[model samples]
Target: MAAAGPGQHPGNRARLIARFGPMAGPWHDALPTLVDGLARRWGLDVGEAGGGGTSRVYRCRRDGDHEGVAAAVWLKLTPDPVVATQEAEALSAWSATPSVVRLLDSDLRVGALLLAGVEPGTRVRESGWRTADVARLLADLRTAPRTRTPLLPPLGERITFMYDMAARRGTHDPEVLAHGRAAALGLAGTGPADGLVHGDLHPGNVLVGPGYRLVAIDPRPTFGDPDFDAVDWAIDGATDEVALRRRIAELAALVPGMSAARVLAWCRATAPLTTGAPAFLVTPAGLRG
Candidate 1:
């Protein structure tokens, strides 16, 4: 499947430029040369892998001098320092796990990664994945040890911070914000278990291949309850409100102790806060149903 570059979609590009401004154009223009140089220095072959939101990933081949390997590696390029650092730190933390992508190196200044790419497979959105697949992937991911070293805050805290930012920026809808705050407070009161949560665990981030095995990519690593991860999969987009609720119910059932009502509220609360976020972060279809 073809992936469109950042700003290629008129509507999305406009919103991004509005929020982030025109500086992205210059940074993007410099990516190809920067990636090429990095590949040469690292003794790897590099070329375009794909593009989404503010980053363009490249397919990289390990240096020929190294032992037996022919497949190219993958490199993700971006101008956002925080996001680049988060991805690198998360990948490094989980590198021992064969199921997660391997991170070879990262250039913080340029926001680039030299990574080991998994064999290509259908994205979860296109792979006809069911709720079972999502549950299984979550179970595997939750096995990673949780850390509170402050690489990224917990999901609940992050949601609260986003609300504060939106309110300060005067971009938040008051009713939605109020509901989100209330729901977040409720979730907090429950004292949900904390683990290494994939802050974004929607279908698009999942990849499936032979034997129906699933692997996840592009994690926004944070610490939180596993149930916090379910919201993204539920209310992505459904023209019919009832249908959306049903999907939420189905997903909540897949995750123990999670209520459909809580998931729905989280989805509604967070969606608006992401309105001006990069395309990779916020899907044009909104969430995905």
Candidate 2:
């Protein structure tokens, strides 16, 4: 096979160039060649390329049987080497109890990771997310970290990034976005750090693995406030305050050490990022943002 690069996919190169600018052009242009190299180095039968997030993802299969690891695997390659390194560290920390996808191997220098594939690969949102399942996963996540990662950024930094990006997009309500960012930062400043926060734990990031288990992927990890991660689930598909409140209560009750108050705070603070769900910014009772 020859090195195809992003030229094979007409839109991908343009998207990468737009997002990461000229510096990303060489990387995208060389991606296919790099994929070929990875397949050779890691014994992978690389399949079709995928488009999502900040990474180039591919379906793959290991050539040899490995203990515990599945034959079917997924490879994530990114342009940012540091992001890849931190992602590996985050995944490794979450792999003991493994509420997230299992990390098989990684090449941090190349910003690549080989991951165990989910059997069905169904996004929980598409499957109609259940609060209980999310609660279970969140609970397990608290105990998932058998290793510590001191280098990970805090939740505040991730929150700042989201608000800043929203400003650049010029889509979200400025008042709401600013309020959300400030509130979110306050929440991040104080809370239990039992586990690493999966900074981007929206429904798209949660997938159904084998045994109908809910596993998370693509963590933009933060080291503060696990409850901050539950905001997405609390607000997911909730069109009104009653529904949001109910979900928050259930999640808080089901997940040990989860605080309903904190989750609500997070939801209010991050509502602008999700387009303010109902314009009240995920209201609860009389209080409104």
Candidate 3:
């Protein structure tokens, strides 16, 4: 487990560069020095670098023990200080819970994090998990304690960004995007701010671990309506309305306050603006719903 930088994957470098636009070239140039510095300081033997879009990750091992457990960690680095600080705060808040990956170490100044590694870390989707199983995970995550940190952005801000992006790109119908913005604003005022919501929860984000049956990793944590998290499964890459309806019903039942209507609103609002074919964004007929 030796430290490696982000230059291995040329395609990943391009994708990252595209993600950052004008700042990409300099960001790419800076990765090697940053990665090496963190590895040395933390005594981390970092492996292959992974492309995490907003951040970079590496499979790492350190010479240490934690309560009789060997030190295996995932090292992540982000250029944005805001994202780095918020993520560290979120992980710290949920350190006591087994449902989420623990924060082993952090250096917010460099936007680096050392996260506990999950054994046999298969993604939930690759593990052949059913929809109900995912719902169960969301329900459990909702029980995790809230953060006292004041910097966590409201979920509405994310929705607004999508809506605004779509509007500027003119790739989505304005009417539909407007509906989503309104719904997000309305829901923000009405929905329950029950507990900490893994703002980016989806099948890919959940992993099957040896210690915990299903655990979440790489959270964009926020304090908000648990329903917002619940609806992610319904609208993400939905192709069939029949199946989508079933998932919506199931999720609403699994997490209280996540009604079909509310979830449907989220789909209609965020779907068209989403990257892939979101469940309710456009029908198979190529018409905006």
Candidate 4:
């Protein structure tokens, strides 16, 4: 991944101001001091910053470490307190699992997290990896020990909210949410709650890591049917019906407890709920209150 320029993502401040209105002012105002405080507290030499819409992320080097060589870490600062808390709790739950990035440290009060950076950090999407490979890694992540974190909503509740939001937005076709609701209900009844789910496990989020062949970043960390974690691959990027069906089949075989029919249901329900106006998109990233 490229180093972020200056503070957080380029143009992120403008976007935040636009999205957050008056309340955003304080968040923006506090960023400089927050960054400085975190740097000094953690002995981090904050470097370039970059991330998507919700947070400011930067590459930083540990200033001092008597234990061994000082390591490079990714520092993320989320504006949403709920998101910050959820992310910190999730990373701690994961505890450096091979499937996801490790959390080195965190300050929930200030919404700062020190994450282990993936060396040779290559996104799986850019790595020329096959669908099967991504599916295997996702399945592996679903196998991590489940953490009883109370921050995340249940899979069922989340699906209901998506439907309600779609109705409120009037952007997506009604039938889509209907089918999604039905699928979600069916999957909820049938699928096992085996582990913590990376609520957003698309290709952009999975990266090649140093010790792990594939590690995921930016997790929503919800408790749900493990198969729910496998649905993103079907509708993530460029794909047609044929491609989608093939990917679903491939994923089902690779991911235990997930089926082609179940994956299809999730896609039909999830795609419309996610791909829409800015509000719809940002809702899932913990931007919506």
Highest-TM-score candidate: 2
lDDT of each: 0.63, 0.78, 0.70, 0.69
Which of the two, 2 or 3, has more lDDT? 2
TM per model? 0.71, 0.90, 0.83, 0.80
Per-residue lDDT for 1-289 in model 3, tens only? 3546544566766766655665755666677777888888888887767756777888877767666544778888776767878888877777766778888788888778888888888987677566666666766776667543577877766666656767787875666666667767677667765467677776788888774477888887777766666656775546777767777887778764456876766565555654554544553232224
Greater TM-score among 2 and 3 belongs to 2
TM-score order of candidates, top first: 2, 3, 4, 1
Summarize candidate 1's per-residue lDDT along 82-178 as a digit string, tens digits. 7778878777766666556678788877887777666665787786667776666655665666666576666776667667767777664566556
At residue 179, what lDDT does model 4 achieve?
A: 59
The reply for model 1, stretches above 4 Å from the true place, is 1-23, 64-68, 96-99, 160-174, 185-190, 235-289
Could you tell me the C-alpha RMSD of candidate 1 in Å? Answer: 6.6
Ranking of models by lDDT? 2, 3, 4, 1
Worst 10-residue lDDT window for candidate 3 reads 279-288
Worst 10-residue lDDT window for candidate 1 reads: 275-284
List the RMSD of every prediction in angstroms.
6.6, 2.9, 3.4, 6.1
